[model samples]
Each structure stands twice: as structure tokens, then as C-alpha cells.
Target chain A: MKTLRVPEATVTRLSIYSRFLERLDRNGITTVSSGEIAEGVGVSPAQVRKDLAYFGEFGTRGVGYNVKDLLKYTLKILGLDQEWALAIVGAGNLGFALCTYRGFNVRGFHIVGVFDNDPTRIGKRIGDLVVQPLTLFPEIAQKENIRIGVIAVPTSAAQEVADMMVKNGVEAVLNFAPVAINVPDEIEMRNVDLSVKLEILTFNLGFRNAQSL
Target chain B: MKTLRVPEATVTRLSIYSRFLERLDRNGITTVSSGEIAEGVGVSPAQVRKDLAYFGEFGTRGVGYNVKDLLKYTLKILGLDQEWALAIVGAGNLGFALCTYRGFNVRGFHIVGVFDNDPTRIGKRIGDLVVQPLTLFPEIAQKENIRIGVIAVPTSAAQEVADMMVKNGVEAVLNFAPVAINVPDEIEMRNVDLSVKLEILTFNLGFRNAQSL
Candidate 1:
């Protein structure tokens, strides 16, 4: 049978849904209805059903979703079933922090190598990984099976680093740089611009303040 | 007349619109058609017009919006017409990174005080301001007129810190902690979770991999 395609929004929310389910699992919830999961994750029950329909039928009409079975399905659907090796570029403050981040390591993702253009930081150790120079990205990726490249470099050098990572056969990249980057259609890119986030909050507060006047 | 209410989604996009407008302003573009601004911000012209209508009609039906007028109105609507003082809790790696962050200062939001429970970090100078203990939040907020709080504490301490900030009279909060937080209905809370972003990327890769199999 041909695999059913899921919307990117649905897949995005699947990660969100999985997080809520993990909380439920910890609270000893062995079963959950669509309404219950929807409320937990702040989505509509109909939307949840529609999103999960593409994967398979995991729910009964009245009994709702089985917690462990649904979690296994979510894990498989999100590729969390297999561990992903991460190559973090730029061993600066942000890069070093990400390498030592317990959150990424806890989520079936491991930072196996830290890459940088800085000579001083290249030989340093962050946790168990010895930092390597940017020149070794392709070599290290080929040998160690590193598929994701994280660009935490400064804005000016971010594009160049992204280009090199794509050239090295990285399929996906998570960019923390403040600038937008251009990557191939086949290469998936996600940008986390801290500045953009602050601007959003500023606007929110601004709107509320204006309303009070 | 009753004040017009803008949708939350439109408020979010207004920040993006303002950023693009700033680029135009820098380039000496004094006026812009709605289509021009929409194209620059990667939104449809109709959507832009619709969003702007939520506040008040600003654009000419044919000629478009006057760039300066639109920019000023958006800024006023977002409450960036004047400066806002902000307090950041937890002067750790993330907090330190945020304090030195050039974006907040540029956007009319000021990080006037940094707070932490650690004695070693408190009283340390980060830029022009000295770090203070969590106990100083109320006094600092009152003295400095800080209206917003940025919470970067660990998950274990997030709720306690947030509760303190709220009691100290912080009406708006931007939480960087990965866990979900409970706030009073009157307080506006926004959570920025980096792990959720990576998980979204994982799901994208998963669907693509599954399709190829």
C-alpha cells in the first residue's frame, strides 16, 4: 500500500501532541480520548482526528486512544524511534550551550560532533565530544553518520556555513542565526531567530498598551 | 467610537511586517503599495489589507499605504511608540546570552535588571547593570518601572520564579523554560520551546523517509 502523505502542519502538531502524551504517560494515564489530548495540546478534537487519520486508526469510538500504542505510533511517525546524530557548527557560547543541552540529548537525538572555524575552540571538549574544525564536516559526517547540521554561528558567516553543510550532504538544518538563509528545496531548514521572537512579544505588549489608552 | 480589535494572528504578523518595513525605510522607500509591502513580507496583498482593516483603514484603495504613516501606526499599535523596561530572571548561560543580545535594546525593550538565586552570580556586572537576587524583583520592578519579565530559569524553578514575578506585578511574561507554566488569567504568557522546533524537523524528515521506503 502507498504511504499516506501528512500535512506539514499536522506533522508539526504531532510533535506537540507527543509531548502532551508523554506528560499523560508520566501521570499514569493509560488511555486518552481525542477531546482530552486536544485540550492538553490546545487543538481541536476534529483536527486531531484528521491529523491522526493519515497514520492509522489508533482510536476506538468510545474508548479513545491507547496511551502506549499511540506513543509508539507517534514515535515511529516522528522518526524518534531511531536516534539522530547531530553535528553542531560553531563552538561559540550558543553552540557550546546546545552541545551540553540536556533537552536535545534526552529526545533520542545526540550531538556527536561540534564543528567550528575558530582554532582555539576546535580542540576543546564539550562533554564527551571533542570539537572539530569546520573543514572536517564532510569527513566526519560520512564516517559518523551525522545527518543534521545546526548553525549557531554569527549572522555574517551563517549563510556560508549553511552552504558548506548542504554541500556536505546534510538533509536538514536548524539555524539559530538571526538572518534568513537560502537552501535547496530538498534541504529542510528551520530558523529560530531569537530577535524575531522578542519583536513578537514587543508587538503583543504594544497592542495591549494601545488598547488601554 | 469603540476601539477596533486586531486578531492575535495579525498582531504576530505585524512584527514581521514592521521588520520588512524597517528594511524599506533604511533603503529610503518613503511610500509603499500594500501589494509591495505584502510581497516583501511574503504575504498576499488581500491579507495585508484585511489585517490592516482590523485597526483602521490606512491605505488608499489604489495607491497603497504611505510607508512612513503605516510604519508609525504599526509601531504605535504595537506599543513601541515609547521605550519599555524589561527584567530577566536567571543569569545563567541563556540569561547572559539574552542580556548581551543587541536585538532587545534596538527594539525599544530594555533589560534593566537581571535576577538569580545564585549568590555567586548576583552582584556581578553584565554590561551596565548588576545581577540581583530574586528577592529584589518587586523593588526593582517598582523602581525601574519594568512591565515585562523574561523567565530563563530551569524547569524546576520556573513556576516559583514566575509566581514571584507575578506577585511583584509583572503583567507580561516570556518564558524560555521547556515545561508548561500556569499563570493567572490576567497575565499574558508566551512560551518559546526550542525542543518543539527540533521535533517538528524530525517529523518532516520522518514523513519524507517513510515515503521513500
Candidate 2:
């Protein structure tokens, strides 16, 4: 491994920058300065430059960066240039919502399989796919070459579901169960806690009110 | 304002620390050190202390912090000590998921109203509350005294829903619409883009692979 030791926060910024660049590209923008990107994304120009530095030199010394070229580079760095098969392990409302979530589809993430343990939901259609039993996760995962798994089940079942995803050869996992799950060190995992986001807003509001006093 | 501005990152960490403290309280743990809190929450001990420093001292020199006391303090700091009334606009699958999400209820958030513009979804039951037409937002928002509004509507309707919420005097907004929204500076707003979280994971995975080469 390279000894540079990139920070996790940088990766997150790169992701944000990538999305911003995509929007720029879509708007017929050809080139963008660091300041422009910063203003567009609510970050500082220095931050934009610093985050881009970790990957490689993308912008010219004086001239700005090409919108399309920078967008492509960022996506490649984020591993979104290639198609990724995803297996969602719940057919609940959250899972059903996720199956149709436009964000994933636009980023080349394909939910090839939706698995659940509920018998009543087994044949339920969510979008274009029927829910499959959890037992079929292994077979479908192998057949579809699924790498990333999303856990949208209850808290009690999150760990078990994560374990199954690991056992079935999924590399990265996006868990939405609002609980921290243990996965192998080699396996990448991220938790998407919807509540935490709201709490952040509340904290800011509270902090602002406290400061005013 | 207090003039001592706290970083949004600190607010996020405080939220995580609050949740970790809740789990400790549930386990009957009465005391926890900053190191232990940091370990449980996957943050550095110094970070835990720094984040807490933004508010006030909560830990003793050697005895650490009282679990219940710290939990209470963090929850209060996050503005979660008192019940908050919420209004969620939209009754789609995503909206349904947010309405029933246990994370909000556990943290003292109550969805008093669910609104939708679609006539078909207007009377649909998400939990105990039935979805009302968006035209009723002003009346219900006034009646319920909602302080926080959640915009889970489609992209096209998100801005309008946010405007309606603002017009009804909602103080803070948590948007899940995957689009950047403009609100007045006095109003607090945060976006919970699920896709951005996944993109962060993909970036890390890609960066690690590149380093290994």
C-alpha cells in the first residue's frame, strides 16, 4: 500500500466535488476554477484545491480544470466509472425506496437482487424485481457478481445480514440499519444513519440559540 | 450569536457521542471516560474532549464523566431534551420510510403531520397519522407547532415544499430530496443525501486498491 495515508474526510470531499462537477458538466460548463467549484459546493477554494491534491494534479497552474475531464477523473477515483452490482437485503419500505433511489442508478450502481426473509414479501414487486429469500443471496450474489450489499433490515438482524453479505463475497457494504456492524477489516463498510443527519441540524440550531445568549 | 463558532463536524460527533451514551445508559453503565466514549464511538479521545469543549466541561480530571449526566447533557446540547414536533411533506415510499423510522422517535422527534400534493396519497396511512393534502400544511403546521420540517418529496416538488414549510414558520429543515436547497440564513437546513454516503465508501475502496498497487 502507498504510505501517504489519505484521510477519510478527503474521500468524502472528493465524492462531493465529483457530484458538483457532474452538475457542471450537465450545464454545458467546459472549465471550472477552484473558487467556482468551492462557491457552488459551499466549501472554500483552498479546500477544493487541497482535496484534489490527494488524487493528482488536475487543474493547471493558472487555468482552471476542464469540467468533463475532472468529472471523469473523480468518478474513476471513486470507482464509479465501472458498473457495480448491489444486493439489497431488505424489502421493507426503506429497501423499496432504495431500490428506486435515483442516486445509485445514476452512479452505475445496479441493484441486481433484493433479498428478504419475509414470506409475504417474497413475490412482492418493487420496481422491476421481485423479492427473493435470503437463502438465495449466495447463489444470486455469485451469479450476478455482486460486490456491494445494502442492509435495510431491523437493528437485530443487521449484524447477521452483514455477516451473510461478507460470507457471500460482497466487498463493500452500505448499511442503513442505524446500528454499527462488525465486518472484516478487508471488507469496506459504511453506515447511513438517517437520524444522525437530523440530529446534526438540531445541534446546530441549539448551538446557534445558545450562542445568541 | 456567542461568537465562538463550533464546526459542523463537531456537532456530528456530538450526535454520535449522544447515541453511544444512550446505549451505555441502557446497559446500566453509570460512568465513562473520554477514552472509552471515543472508543465506543470510533473517534479519538482528544476529539471527544475537543467536541465537548465546544459546549462546556462535562468530565472530571480523573473520574471521567457520569454516563447518565453526560447523556443528558449531550441530548440537551443537541436540542433533543424536549419533544419536537415534525412535519414530513410527501407520502411516497421514501416518505413512508422516514415517517416510521424509529431513530427519530427514539430521539424525541414526533411526526405530527404528513403532507402530500397527490390526491391518491392524501388519506394514506403511514403510521398513526394519515397523509394530508399539502394545502393543509399551513393549518396543521400552525396547529401542531412544528419546529422541524422534513422534505422527502421528489426533486421537482422539494423546493416548493421547503418554501411552504418556511412560510409556515418551520425553524429547521432536514431535506432528503438529494438536491441543494436555498433557505434564508436565519433558517437552519441540512441535506441527508444517501447517495453521497455510498460514494464516500466507493472512494475509499478505490483509494485503497490504488495504494495497494
Best-fitting candidate, measured by TM-score? 2
Which regions in candidate 1 have their CA more than 4 angstroms from the true location?
A1-9, A43-47, A50-56, A199-202, A206-213, B1-9, B33-50, B58-64
Q: Candidate 2 has which clashing residue pairs, if any?
A: A211-B2
Score every model by TM-score: 0.89, 0.96
Worst lDDT run of 10 residues, candidate 2 chain A, spans A1-10
Predicted candidate 1 versus true structure: per-residue lDDT over B15-115, tens digit per residue: 77877777788899888888887877667988888887777768777777777788888877777777878899988877877787666677678888999
DockQ of 1: 0.49
Model 2 CAPRI rating: medium
> In model 2, which runs have C-alpha deviations exceeding 4 angstroms?
A1-3, B1-3
Q: What lDDT score is found at residue B130 in candidate 1?
A: 92
